[model samples]
Target: MNDAAMPKGPATALEHFDVLIVGAGISGIGGAYHLKQQCPGKSFVVLETLESFGGTWLTHTYPGIRSDSDLYTFGYRFKPWVGPPIATADEILKYMGEVIEENDLSPHIRYRHRITNATWSSRDNLWTVEAERLDTGQAVAFTCNFLWMCQGYYRHSEGYTPEWPGMADFKGRIVHPQTWPDDLDLKDKKVVVIGSGATAATLVPAIADDCGHVTLLQRSPTYFIPGRNANELADILRELKIDEAWIHEIVRRKILHDQDLFTRRSFEEPEAVKQELLAGVSAFVGPEITEKHFTPSYRPWRQRIAFVPDGDIFQCVNRGKASVVTDEIERFTEQGILLKSGQELEADIVITATGFNLNVLGDISFAVDGKPLNFADTVTYRGMMFTGVPNLVWVFGYFRASWTLRADLVADFVCRLLTHMDEKGARKVTVELRPEDKDMPLSAWIDPENFNPGYLMRGMHLLPKRGDKPEWQHSQDYWREKEELPLIDLDDSAFVYAGTKARTPEPVG
Candidate 1:
């Protein structure tokens, strides 16, 4: 392979790389690092649509934007997170930036390159990716042996907001957190925020002091884990002056172990786990408020349980700066909203912190062997590679645990698969259902009963199907995946390797 032969920029010629990673977010950054460190022999490039790195952190500009999951696990396994357990978006971006600077990943990443189409050719064992440079509006192309999709599974252009009657009649501004405006002022204005998800929880407290009155209006209550942001294990390790890397590994393991136990108890001892979670919130807002606004009908862990970090949200509620209203919205009123209970609430600004719309595969049109790819028609292989999709892996993270946890696992899997392909003199590899799995029952990507969020429920039809087997389903259990992903049998019959193309020798300077 010669550097002189690579495509320089926007041109009719396609740049050649051993691997092309989509998105430069946390997953994408980690993927790039893994490819560089584990498979140094492979040439790779990361294409991000945004002007800079940090996919979600860069796109989301809403106040109080922070991670619900702890940074110990949310941060990359190779990186040492020195911040508090819960981190703000700025802190996260700084951390991700350090990863890039430390690893010299900036040169390998091309910003403003929005991939529009990815076509796989079986004969050539290559993927031709088409992209448009958002800055210049010029189209670019790249050819790669493998496509790594780290683009997240959500619509970044806008957040999902349910249409309410008479929204146009309202005299105030209505905004979704995903697309929060900078010039908008909330000072001395009565605000109403809709939805009970993490976004709502994060926003209410963030703007409570500035707003005249902020109310969290939810149709139903959701579970929350209100606690201190500090991790006791990390605190002790720091006191002992232990190495930062050692502390990170120790705290990460402790958190994952506790999370697994808590998740298992949510199903095994639903009543007990529910009471424990309620007690945590009750400690801050009291039993009445906890039962009325924090108690959820479903068991704990059904949906994500956000960590409140020093009970910040509850503190605002306790001090009378913010309030919670549990009722369905009948329609929008001239001033605010009309509830089903015949109550009218007044508001000057409405923030719909309602979830995001799922965008599968970065909303890129994909094709295999010249046929359009209908993801719903295919079944996921361990929630990464799909049936009949060759030389590609989609990094879909976990639901219960931190997302980067699985990202690291998938990185290792991809690196291993690439190395194995090189050793076998193969250029393409696709996962197919084994003969024994041909008749297995198939269902939605994720079971509603296990973990059903509004966004997932609304976009389940757009996702791929999943089989009953462990290898076929995502099995969002990070604790198990951390142990299993490393030991996966790459030689299993489920993996079909093809094409006898040998690796090209590197060119001398």
Candidate 2:
């Protein structure tokens, strides 16, 4: 976030671009790259609210912060990830930085610019977006033919931490994983980490050796699958002296295929998958701890399944450096906490690895033609565009697969749409539900009741819905999307292609 590099004092003159992307994270970078290569003539700029980029990679600095999934899937498709498949936060950040620098994307990024509201004028056929420059608190205005939301779903500023009784009274230092202080010394301190998600799993083992001990307190069990952090195929290829490009391609496909198989089995035969997953955990933590702290009540993949490298968390617990407690918190004492199971735990510090608060489109209020935009009143078209919204695409990745896989897909798709609109001489394009669709029943973005993860369940009301038709549905299956998304039919009746020029707004203050 080079605020000094930006225009000082009050923002003067209006900034207009062919496209405006409301994020400078991984997805935003990918989107910008696609826009540059595919839609060469389209002028676009990425606006980041933060002082810097990398999104979550930049925000979270927790002890054991790392990618929950392998890096090959998480990395950009166009870029080659030569490092280990699973990477630490810093390593991933460096990788992303290299991508940004190599592609020369920094010039197009405006950091510390937070979008406040977006108004789409149908008569003018453009979006007037208002943003505040964080450094100077000065308002800035921009107009674009299309607005791309690459800001991910989570609230970057605040993470979800449940209220436990006596939390405030506890004398021990309290911390949330999202906002871990760099200078907070945890060395030899008895730590109690609350929650059993991916963050907690990573944190327990990460600080186990240095800290006095870590106790992962969870209300329920979560499934874990152990795998090597590095790709064996990549190693084998290197040993055989294969080309780096060939090795990357081969190993990338292998990881994707393996994950696809596991996901397929989890959906098709959850019981068998559950047994196999628990068996892996049992091998690491032993049958006793597996039964007590690893066996979840729900079916496998109902929530996300975590990946463990060499069963590190279990190894730490077995070595007495860390422990896991499956119990509800009754109250937080100054010394520690009281469990609902009539057990008390002593702690000098507590870390809440609770989930995140979901924020859609960077929490930017939206309106079209002077009427407020209600996401619930619209249907998703190809999981990207909303029925009533014109020339906007939300880059939400797949929950089951690697996030960047969908990011690449979305970047490509948006580029194609822009190219199509240009060729059609369309001034303003809007996705309006078909006349027959009015009779169709609307459904939630996803069935939170079925696959109820905390973030998704809590934010269901804020998300967009889907119609009954295939085009309106959001399919989480990446393999299916791989085959279909690139071939999007421009002639579909779901979109209105017209030659109306976008309206320009008044000058900015």
- Per-residue lDDT for 1-509 in model 2, tens only? 55546554555577888999989888998899888889889888999998888999999998878888888779887777888777898998898888888888899999989888999887778888988898886788888999999999899988998888998879889899998888888899999999988899999999998898889999998888887777888989999999877777788899889888988888789899988998998887788889989999988777887788888898898899998899999999888999998899999999988899999778888999889988877789877888878889999898888889999999988888888888888877778888888788888988664477888888888888887777888878898899899988877887798755666556557
Per the 3 Å backbone cut-off, how many clashing residue pairs does candidate 1 have? 0
Q: Can you tell me which runs of candidate 1 are displaced by over 4 Å? A: 1-11, 502-509
Ten-residue region with minimum lDDT total, candidate 1: 1-10
Ten-residue segment with the worst summed lDDT in candidate 2?
1-10
- Model 2 CA lDDT for position 136: 81
Q: Report the Cα lDDT for residue 422, model 2.
A: 81
lDDT at position 402, candidate 2: 84
* All models, RMSD in angstroms: 4.2, 2.6
Best by TM-score: 1
Which number leads on lDDT? 1
Query: Candidate 2: misplaced stretches above 4 Å?
Result: 1-11, 503-509
What's model 1's overall lDDT? 0.92
